[model samples]
Target: MAEKIRLKVKCHACGYVMEGTSKYGKGNYHPEGLDFQFTAVGKLVDKAGNSRVKGEVTILCPNCETRNRFDI
Candidate 1:
């Protein structure tokens, strides 16, 4: 069974925090490449099958109204 995890993210620029659910990232194989959507919570897999969450996450800071990128 697949387990759902909660990803708690915080914005360094404005100290805004967001908590959401996440899952293993999956995409459709296309002629050009794999296609996926930008999700608040999902893992990214490389060609090697190694999967991991995106190291850098961009979110809109509610406090500052600025888009900030943060490292998890």
Candidate 2:
């Protein structure tokens, strides 16, 4: 099977780099509308040597070119 990928989505029309729920490095999933499912999260560290997860998110926009990320 192919490996999964993670990336920060770039809104083409608004140029928005979503911050929260986007503090990710890499992850995996099978997106056949939940026929299969899996997810993994990386570590996050702050300037103070602290860490906290921002969690996963799903965002949709109707007026722009926003699309679901593919694990390629």
Index of the highest-TM-score prediction: 1
Q: In candidate 2, what residue range of length 10 has the lowest lDDT sum? A: 18-27
Which tens-of-lDDT digit does each residue in 1-72 have in candidate 2?
333324445555576653222222334343432222224444467999966433343544344646434221
lDDT, candidate 1, 1-72, per-residue tens: 233434466767767676554444344211212121233355678999966655444556667776765555
Index of the highest-lDDT prediction: 1
